[model samples]
Target: MTQIEENLFSEFWDKLNGATGKGFGKTVSIDQDIEFYQELKYNNGVFAAFKVHRMQNDMAARLLDENGELKSFKQWLNDVQTIADHQVEQWFRTEYDTAVERAHLAAEWRQFEREAGVLPNLEWIESTSVTPGKDHKIFWGVIRPIMDGFWNRHKPGDRWGCKCGLRATDKKPTPVSDLPAGESDEPAAGLDNNPAADGKLFSDSHPYFTDHYGSKKNILLESDKLMTKYSREEVRKHFQKELKGKSLMLQASQGLAKTISVSHQDIKTITGKPHKYNYMKNTCCYWLPQLLKKAEYMGWSPDMKGTAVPGHGDVKNWHYYRFPLNNEDSFLVVKERMNGEFRIHAIQDKEHFKENKLKNPFEKR
Candidate 1:
């Protein structure tokens, strides 16, 4: 018999077992040559011989391949592992995009409901992620397009569909503060009766906006439905863009009567004194670029022009004309008092904006 026939017959005998029943002295033999080989007639029940044989060969091939090292099986296993990793990464990407899209859609739906004055049964399910909370709250006005895109293109179980079912639960209860002494855990005995809980409850209730909130600080005023109704430029003009910087001085009195008082008399004594020679007395602030250019104008040397300011050679290559003036530089001319309004432009100290306190533009000698 051939190798294929031998493999087939081997599987056939393994399946045949326990022949003591109704067939009185009857016996069955394995057949391999017949192409129409259907069932193996046993004393008990019939079995599909060809099908079982084929399955045996396939299983044998798999086991042998798996047992061998650096074979086709190893290669196939590696490929399968790679595919599984790729699938997991793809799932994470899809989930992340969906989370962002959901936030945008929720914001848009809320806007629509507010505008129409019709309360819809649709409540938003937020993704259980902390990273997007701040972003979700901001730019809420411009998120309608993103929401519409997801809503129209996504179907159930699609990449953008909400499948994770991950939602935020449990909010902290407002604590009671300034509560009066009582037998039971009750509110304050004050006239208002509602004790402020840990001061945080009132803090949360108070209107809080981010550093850039309601401001065109870095935002460009664009024409939109909301912008048209409530002009962006008009609203942003009043927004407080200034940051609260470190206080050089301290307040003397407590609540209501509080006023800033200079405690460090030594600091005032050292910094308040006027310069003796007054190098800036006759200098014009407009000619600052000319003074700066003494170091170099792109590549021109000081010998080709006037005397270069010492130690300013490093800044010569710097494109100050294209660059915004340092706010500290405002102090340089501060020494050279200008007769005009003395208005400080916001752009002068774009990066150095620390509190409202002015930085000395002129480097101290």
Candidate 2:
């Protein structure tokens, strides 16, 4: 590796180690939280380099091996030098894309806070590139409702290798005809202009912009350790407080509900299910209350009725309630016992729900 590469490797190593609470070379004190973020950024950079450089996964794994001690700077240098010039360019492009997105989101978040309640709409002001294409020109100075389909769907820097950025503006955007004409005849470099064969526009090709733009604020806030550490009950209570008196319909429930409740045991049961999807476990903690809330609104009408739990013999009074949670349907199996106590036999996602369908006593009938 050259001098610059050597320095960069050393810096990354130091930051990574320091973030893990192990100082390198000299003891450099840093706030643990700050170090955590720095460590993530450095790790992302390394992984991006590995991916863009097309380094084999096994080689990357070996470099990170910590059986004995951290690898030396020379060892890292040897590994990095394997990356070719084109790979380095790809790595830079990835980094540039991420940096631009983060900066834009940060600025937008700040402006959102500053202009709260003052600006109901925002416009995307694309940076005037020398060779603006039809795709770029169409989006230039276009005003749209913030958080609506058009704005959410066509945020700047959505396309692969796109360098164009957007500035949020409150003032009405100037008409396209009134805007200055493009200076160059060619389209923007590295941009794909051809629409999808189905006639989907270039903007529609990328969906991340629509899914993530509106959630940027919540995403950043949730990244903090404190926010992530909230217990399931706490999260449920918070949402309940927020949704109180609001007419919210659960897609699965198909009706407006007043309140929802999930016991701590319910959370435990769902999360502790063996062979459950990893996401089902994670989302159960956060989405359980929401699902229950929707369930309450839906009035507990089971799509499929009269199920029985296996191994416990036939029970005719059992009912199943299915609701959507985090893009997947989850089911709550409940049986009313002779003593009048409601017993929850199982709480499962759509996958498990399907697997256990035969166990349902009503399925046979």
Candidate 3:
């Protein structure tokens, strides 16, 4: 696989596994869950695209080289499409099952927390389907603190196809100790007993925990969707033909929409004060340019009908638009000045906007 393919697969795996971890820690957010589902769909699309590229190359080779009686191009195309479809379907099913399992585990953890009033200690429960490994047998009855890094690495269902589970207990956990004269301190050969230099108790290389924690440096950003579909040269040429001088501005705006770089001025304008949820600011930044792009593409003029400014009379030249972001309605209010420049006057959800009765800023009368 190419570097991009490998990175995509790695990201898909991490997001699938990390769902449970985030749930256990109560750090899961709607934004994270939405991104998780989006990444899964994106990865499947990438795989399908790659398959098409490979099929095209293979068809060319078969036509040129004398191999066993070559099939018709039509036949070859159908076979390739069938295989690609199957692969994509299988990928979706596998990932979807894993995501469901992780979500269930997270829900269980939440319920456990609500009833137990503390992180529940886990008791490793070995399955009876297969002969238990020596390490599994040793840890079978052992109870471990939920807060320890060991659970992060060695939680039940850590391995692929693992049928093991953990039973929650409110009692104190059994401490790790030497079994006999020659027994090793570690539970298994590859699993490490010490934390890494980064203060992570789990090894970065551990298969179960490797993808659980780390920055996603290789995952493609959403703004890259347009660039990925069309090359930079192609996009630039198209823009030159259509937008002329504004092409650069469009390109820069689209690029900025993918990142979490919100301006302090925009944040203050939207929230009146610093808001606790940074995700809201980031979401606004991402969608603002997207909304503009959609309007331009659809050739829809901005809606500038002003609403009553609560105590103040109706203000003119204020534009309003609403779009769904993270499964919520994001209402944006902007003002077009005399110079034709647009300024983001305010942004909030539909409910919040209605509740606050916010309006356009004005000079003291």
Best by lDDT: 3
Backbone clashes in model 1: 9
Estimated TM-score for each candidate: 0.18, 0.38, 0.38
lDDT tens digits, residue span 1-365, model 2: 10113233333333333323321222322211222223333333333222222333323444653675666777856766656443445644453444444333433433454463677456666654565445555566666445444533454544444445544456664554654443432332222222111111222213222333234334333222221232233444554566564423222233222232334444445444542333333334444434444442212222334235432443334445665543356666554443333444556666665534434433332
Write model 1 residue lDDT over 36-64, tens digit each, in one string: 01111120011212222233333344433
Query: In model 1, where do residues sit more than 4 Å from their true spots?
Result: 1-104, 110-352, 358-365
Sorted on lDDT, highest at the top, how do the candidates line up? 3, 2, 1
Comparison by lDDT, 1 against 2, better one = 2
**Model 2, which residues run further than 4 Å from truth?**
1-77, 80-121, 125-141, 144-154, 159-268, 272-281, 296-319, 326-328, 334-347, 351-365
* Candidate 3 lDDT tens digits, 215-310: 233222321342233222333344345544431222212211222222334434454422222234333443344454432110112234434344
Predictions in order: lDDT: 0.24, 0.40, 0.41
What TM-score quantifies how close candidate 2 is to the native fold? 0.38
> Residue 77 in model 2: shift from native, Å?
7.2
> Candidate 2, overall lDDT?
0.40
Residue 38 CA error for candidate 2 (Å)?
A: 24
